[model samples]
Target chain A: MNRYVKLVNFELGRFMKVYIALIGITIISQLAAVIVVSKSYLNNANQAMNVDHMAIETFIEQYGRMSFNDVTNSIFFIGPIALCIVTLLIYSLFIWYRDWFGKNTFIYRLLMLPTARLNVYLAKASAIFLFVLGLVGLQILLLPLERMILQWMVPIDLRWDLSINEMIRNFDRLGIMLPYSIAEFAIHYGIGFMAVIVLFTIIMFERCYRLKGILLGIGYGALALIVFFLPVFVQEFMLYNYFYPEELFMLMLVTGLLVTAGSIWMSNHLLTRKIRV
Target chain B: MIEVKDITKKFGRKQVLRGVTFTAAKGEITCLIGINGVGKTTILNAIMALTPINSGQILIDGAKINKKSYEKITFIPDAITMLPQMTIGQSMQFMQDFYESWNQERATELLGFFKLKPEEKISSLSKGNTAKVNLLLGLALDVDYLLMDEPFSGIDIFSREQIAEVFTSHLVEDRGVIITTHEINDIEHLIDQVILLDDGIVVKAFNSEEIRENEGKSVVDVMREVYQQ
Candidate 1:
C-alpha cells in the first residue's frame, strides 16, 4: 500500500471511537424523536376526545395531522445534528493539537517519518474529510429510516407523507447540507473541503510558531477567507456589469484552487521547517 | 560522519545555541556533556532535523540532510514519542510501517533485553521502562548513526545499568552515536569523545584517550575543572 494511504488509515483509526459515538448518538436520537413526536400527536387526540368530552369526529378534526416538520422541529432531532456539527468542528482543532500537547509528544515521531512530511498534513486533512462525509452520509441515510418510523407510529390519514427530497427542501439546514443537484453538491462540499484545508494550514502555522504564531495564523486565515470571497464581492460591486454566472464560477474555482494549493504548500513547509516539539 | 557547522538557534529572545559546531564519526561514541539548559538536547534535535535551527547546516556523509538521509540515522528523544494509547507492539508496528531500516528481529530481541512486554501500554509503563522502550526503538533500527537525548535522565539506577550494558553490546557496535547527558557517571567508560558544553558553548571537545594521555584527566575531572570554574 502507498504510504499516504497507510497514513490516512492510521489517522482515521485515531478518531474512529469518537466518530462512532457521534453516529450512534445521531441514530438513537433521530429514532426517539420520530416516536416521541408520534406519541404526542396520539396523546393530544386522546385528550381531546376523553378529557374534553368531545366527539371522535370533532377530536379528529382538531388534531388529526403529523408532518415531517413536526418531527424535525423537535429538540431530539435537532440536538443530535447540532451535536455532530459542533463535535466535528472541535475535533478538527483537536486532531492537530493532540499530537503536540498529548501526554506523549507524538509529533516527533510523525515529523521524523521516512516519507515526505506533507503526508502528515495530507493524511490528517483526508481524515477530516472522511469524518465530515461520514456524518453527511449518515444523516442522508437516516432521513428515510426516520420517515419509516413516523409512518409506523401514525395512521395513514393523520400523516403528511413526503419524499426525502421534499423533506430536505423543506428544512433550511438540511437543504444547505444535501444540495438538490450534483453540481450544487460538488460546489458546496468542494468549497467546504477547501475551507478545512485552509484551517489546517493556519493550525500548522500556530504549531510552528507557538504563542507568537497565534496572531499570525489568524491573520493568514483571515487573508485566505477574504481572497476566497473576493470574486463574489467584486461581482457584486465592481464587476456587476461585466461577468456572467459562468465567468463568476470560473473566477471562484480558480481562486479556490489557488488558496488550496497555497495552504497545502505552506502546511508542508511548516511541517518541515518551523514545527517545534 | 555527521557534521554540524556553526548552528545557531534562539527561542524568542533567548539564544539556546550559539554557533555550535561538532562532528560524530562512524564507530565512535561522542558524548555531549553539559549542565541542564545548555543546548545538549537542542543539538541532537537539530542534527536529526527534529527542530529547526535559526542558522546553520547539518550534513550526513557529505550531503545535506533530507527525508532519505533519515534512513541512515535515528534519534531517540528522552520523552516517550510513541502514542500513549498504543501498546509497545503497536508502536513497533507503526515504526515498521514508516521505516525501511526497522529490524523486527532486533526489536524483538531488544524487547527481551529491556524486559518490556509487547502488550504494555506506553502510558502504563514505569518511567524506566518508557526510557528503555525509547532506547530500544532507536537501537533496533539498522542505521549508521544514533542520536540520543538524555536517555539516562531520571531513570532508576538498575535501568540505567541495563541501558549502559547495551552500549557495550553488539547492538551499538558499528554506529556513530551522539548522546547528551548531565548525569554521565554510568557511561563514562563507554564514550570515545567528550564535548563539554557550558551556557550553549562548547568549552572543550577532546577525544577521551587524548585527554587521558595528555592531561591524565578523567571525564569527571575535566567536568569539574570546566563547571567549577
Candidate 2:
C-alpha cells in the first residue's frame, strides 16, 4: 500500500499541470451545459404560462415546423466528456514517454517498473476514479450557482433540488431502505467501473499475440454475461429477493474477486514480466 | 552473481542470440561489445529477463529470474521512450514511488550533477542529457545487478565521461553492471570483463586485462578483429 501510494503520488506530481488544465476545461464545459439547459427551460416556461400567447405560439410554431438538425449541438454536449478522455490520454502518453528509465517504448518502460505490475495498473485506475469523483463533486457544488445564473438570464422562478435527495424523500413513504440501496448501487457500479478500466489497462499492456488478447477479452465478456444473470440465477435458485442483502453482498464479492484476480494477473504476469517481443 | 548458460533467442526465423554462455560476479562491470545486428542488446535483454530466451535459462545469484525476481535486478536500456511529456521531477516521483530500491537522494544529486533541473521536461532535454538521466537511474537503484544496454552509444564525449564516472563511482561491493556498447573507449579502463558477441553468439568472453595482454590491443581493436570488420 505504501509503495503504491508513493508511486501514484509521484505520477500525479509529475503531471500536475496537465491535470489542472483538464479540470479547468471540464468546469468551463459543464458551465456551458448549465447555461444551455437554463435557456431552454425558460423558453418552455414562457409558452406554458401563456405570458405572450401570440408571440410564444409564433416562435413555437416556427421552431416546431423547422427540422432541428442538432448534430453540431449534440457534438457540443460531448465537449466535457470528450475533454476528460482526451486530456487523460495526452497526460498518460506524456508520462509514459518521458519517464526516467532508458527504454525504447512507453509500454516496455512501464512493464519494467520494479513494483508489482498490478500497482501500476491500480494507480492509473485510481486516478480515473478520483478524476470522476472530483468532477461529480464540483457539479454538485456548482449546481446552485447554475440556478442563480439561470434566474439572472431568464424571468422564471429559479429553483434547484438535489436530484438524489429529492428522490430519497419521494421514496421515504415506502420505507425501502433507500440509503442501503444507494450504498449497494455505489459498491456495485464502482467495482464494475474499475473492472472495466482494469480490463483496458491489461489489454494495453498485454504482450501476448493479438489473438491472445482478443481471447482474453472474449473470456472476460463471457464472464460478464454470467454475472449479468446473477439476479435471475438467484431468483431461480431460491425465491424472490430471499436473502436479498446476502445475495447482493455475494454478487459484489464475486465481481470484486474476479476484478482483483484479473488485476493481479495483468500486473504480475503480463504487465511486468511479459516480453516486449 | 549472474549466469547464462546455452541461452538463445530467435525473432521469427532470424536468431538474435545463439547458444550464449557467460557469467558475472558481484561488483563487476562487464562490457558486451559486438558489430551491429550481432545481438549484443538481445543478450542484455535476456539477462535482464526483459526478453525471454527461446532455449536456455538465466540464473541471477543462483536463482532463475522469472516473473517473481524483478527486485534482484534493474535494467537500463538505451533510448528511453516511456513517458515523454513529464518533466524530470515527475519521472523522479514515479521512480521514487514504484521501486523499493529507489535512491531518491542519489537521483536528486545526479540530477544536479547532470545539470538537469526538475522543471525541464525530458522531451526537451538533449539526447546527451537523456542518456545522462538514464545512467542516473541505473546508478541510483540499490540493486544487486544493473544491466545497461549501450549506455553511451549515442551520447557525446563530455556526457560519456560523466556517465563513465558515475558508473564507476556507483560500483560498490556486491553490485554488478553489464553494459553493451560499441564505444569501448568510454569504459575500457573501468570495464571488469569484456564479452564480445558475433552473430548472436559469444565469440569471446574474458577479463578486460587478459584481452589487453593476450591480443596486445585496445578493446575496440579486439572487437574489430573479432567481428572481422
The DockQ of each candidate is 0.77, 0.46
Where is model 2 more than 4 Å wrong at Cα? A13-22, A36-113, A151-180, A201-205, A210-256, A259-263, A275-277, B65-72, B89-119, B165-174, B214-225
The candidate that achieves the highest TM-score relative to the unseen native structure: 1
lDDT against the true structure, per candidate, is: 0.89, 0.65
Candidate 2 DockQ category? acceptable
- Candidate 1 residue pairs in clash (backbone atoms < 3 Å): none
Across residues B95-193, which tens digit of lDDT does each residue of candidate 1 receive? 898889999999999999888999999999999999998988888889999999888888899999999999999999999999998887888889998
lDDT of 2 by residue, B1-229 (tens): 8888999887767988889999988888887787688888788777766666789878898987653455568778787634677777877776766667788888888888888888888788899998877677666777888888787887788988887777656443458878888767767898889888887788988887877788687777777777775
Model 1 misplaced stretches (Cα beyond 4 Å)? A50-64
A1-277 in candidate 2: lDDT tens per residue? 5766865665666666766777777667656765676567566656654665646446545443111111113344347656766666564434433442344455555656665666766776566556555655664465456545545665432333334444334433211322336675476556646555555544544344345666775676566556645656677686776657687777657766666566556545654455443
Scored by DockQ, the top model is 1
| Per-candidate RMSD, Å | 1.5, 6.3
lDDT of 1: 0.89
